[model samples]
Target: MITRSVQTVQTNPDDIIDIRQKIAGSWQEILSQAVTNPQELLDILGLDQALLPGAVVGSQQFQLQVPHTYIARIRKGDPNDPLLRQVLPIGEEMVITPGFSFDPLGEKPKNSHRGILHKYQGRLLLMPTQLCGVNCRFCFRRHFPYEENTLNREEWLSAFDYIRSDTSVTEVILSGGDPLALNDNRLAWVVEELAKIPHLRRLRIHTRFPVVIPQRITKELLNWLTGTRLQPVMVIHCNHPDEVDADVADAMKLLRDHGVQLLNQSALLKGVNDDADVLIELSERLFSCGVMPYYLHLLDKVQGAAHFEVDEQRARQIMSGMSDQCSGYLIPRLARENAGASGKVVIAPLYSLKI
Candidate 1:
């Protein structure tokens, strides 16, 4: 079981005010004032001083950036909070594990263009921004060279030209730190440009914006997302049931009403939603919010996140447990991504006891 330090400190008043101010505004406003300091995050949650040293160390590798809106869902003073575990940096991150690397997915080599990753046939990734509202500790792209990949206006046109050149490319995936991190005006222009491509049939957005900052689902965002002729599909990243609150539900409903196909994908973290009960409830909660359960991903073996990994045998066992209780449609496919593999490999759960 995951545990934390015993020493606790009083919540800082200035921190409270800063968080409150960030909480009450447009999504951009909230994101702009995101809690970046490790001390500030620990202070806000009333966590122990023991966590600060490791957090400081981890944040140095990849800066801590959590929106106040998302922090609102975490349980104050509890070190074992599932939602907190996803964002909190820890001492284990320093441990050097074999088979773990900076570019685990081998995305660096596949980055064919400035912002394009054409790993698979028929579909290509178009990264528009290098920003995310909340940075999950286990993100595979934590060490990705965003500076090299982020596109300018001319570069975006170059990317479109590449897509047009490849007539086989039918789908364009908007990925990044998170594509929704870009403002609607820029996003709409990107979509409009994509729509101009004769071969493109769908626009898939992989984002955590709606989950972390519900207010990001604005009227203008919806207008562009649905206005284009290309079919819009959004795959949101949510690991636990608590992540999907009433506000998240409303954001999802807005998307569904706008005809966006909603699906969810989660990393199977050791202490966060690794149990069968939590996974079952998460599926039910997602269904209530109009999103279908999609992929339950095995942790990507990134350098700093080996602590979050659940080995395949254990993952299969947990999925088998979920299979026993949940209906077929509610259960997500258990999948893993390999660097050179054509696509995600689906792993079927253990169904019967061996002799």
Candidate 2:
């Protein structure tokens, strides 16, 4: 197997619980202290030996990344837990499916601007950082050439100037490798620069930081978030209700309290949140936590995550069933981003304006 050796986690009981106590105060320290090792995650959860080798192999291709706050929610010893399934790297990831490719959404061709991606008209995606708080196993951008896109001070200034010249671009989206992974000062600087552009009407941030590491919702992060002149919108991602514990809810609520419009998008993953019941629960939970359901994304056909994809027919069925049980606002649009498409095509059947 083409894999690098992972440092073993010292499973002595004190060391296990000690890190948890130490990470209590600061989200910066918590992010700095995310658990990247597969064995350390397994040891903490008390998982069995049967799952180890596959996890080790998969981690090499896309390293296992889950913050302690997110891990604490998983039910110990249950391999099928929704949260675990999303983060755990299993043997199935090694298979190269016929249809799946490195650039599933055709993003490589859309690299028209430095550190900027123009997929849909009127909006551009700015990737200030190629880092994330938690590296989700099924992420479509798993193979993204982020290293090449890492823009320095002058490059970013050039990119910002590029945005200023594009009169048609009205929305600036901050995506990543989860954009919120950047420190408050760094993100603030970018926001301040972007706010000067007169054409931009909205500053949309697509992130998973608040959910994975609730402590990431610090006051310094909020200062720029609220201070920005552009209309601030946050698109958070969460696959299952279990992922939204009390801490996650509080973090989201902090954003809500600060006037950041909260919206959520989730990928429809097999064995994770495919069930109608699960979808319904997730929607209701999301609404209670101050987020409106935005998109139920059909899995982006990317390599290593074909196992997680649910077919279009089945996806529609699940959405239909969810519509029957959930309130209209809670029912997210079932959307797919076909390569080279102008926008996400909504295919969720029987979806009407009326609840």
Candidate 3:
């Protein structure tokens, strides 16, 4: 049995329990819940063998940890479901490839300052927290050096200094495991520090917490988010339409109501939402909920995520189908991030065969 500290709890366990209690303290509520134990989560998704190889005994006893909010959102009895796709670890494809690496983005090399990743011009990525509600199997940053990237108060202040020193930077992006994973107090402090930098005009937060764990969107979170000096933009990650339920809708509405511009970036995963119909519905749902469909990203060529990759030709076809059905606004930019590239490259559809 592998023993570890409970600090790795995805969503705050106490907060999750409290939210469940507040909604209704019923056994049915508890039973219908998604994987609360880590082992059970692995079993439901069939990730035990993939994650921990050669470890058979006491594996069943291991409790798979799933946050109550994320659990509440999952459709029952469907293991291959799209909502389950993001969190569940399948088999390891990491061993097969040599090129697929831990830091494909070269984030460590670009770490100009503490908590700051200055890879491109005019924008900087700040790593505020090293935690996320659900660990996506295809995450490019899954192997990121979270322990090394953590910033202390002085280090955080120094990051602001780095930003202020660079006159070209206009945008500051908060990202890590997920910026929303940090408590309101910590987040607000970071925001306040960034606000001090006169050149940093826009603040962008990339997070999946609001979609996966809606309870994290407390009123206090909204207040601090909206009250900030920088123009706040929240890019939420949601791939499928089914992922958007009433609770998620409420959270999105709250963010929108508070003058936080909302956008969505989705990855094209194999079992998740590869179909044109699924993509169309997801875009429509996002538009209806006051979020602009920003970018439909091709899966990053990570090792274990080879299962999720759809080839360029098929992706282009899907994009073309989406264009014919949905309004132009609803059609997201089909793009891919080339390693060491300045910005995401938009992949245009092929016109005709030239044999």
lDDT winner between 1 and 2, please give it. Answer: 1
Cα lDDT of model 2 by residue, 228-335, tens digit: 888899999998999888777867777887899999999999999999899889888889989999999999999999999999889988887887776788888889
The lDDT of model 3 is: 0.74
Model 2's number of clashes is 0
Candidate 1 residue lDDT tens string, 16-116: 33343355788889899899999999999999989999999998898889999899999999999999999998888888899999898888778868999
Distance from true location, Cα of 52 in model 2, Å: 1.0
Query: Which residue pairs of candidate 3 clash?
Result: 37-63, 37-64, 37-65, 38-63, 38-64, 38-65, 39-63, 39-64
Question: Candidate 2 or 3, higher TM-score?
Answer: 2
For candidate 1, the C-alpha RMSD (Å) to the true structure equals 9.4
TM-score per candidate, chains pooled: 0.92, 0.92, 0.83
Tens digit per residue, CA lDDT, model 3, 37-101:
44565555454344444122212322223565665556665666787766655444434466566
> CA shift at 291, candidate 3, in angstroms?
0.6
Q: Candidate 1, which ten residues in sequence have the lowest lDDT sum?
A: 12-21
Show where candidate 3 strays beyond 4 Å: 1-21, 24-38, 42-65, 350-355
Which pairs clash in the backbone of model 2?
none
Model 1 residue 293 CA deviation in Å? 0.5
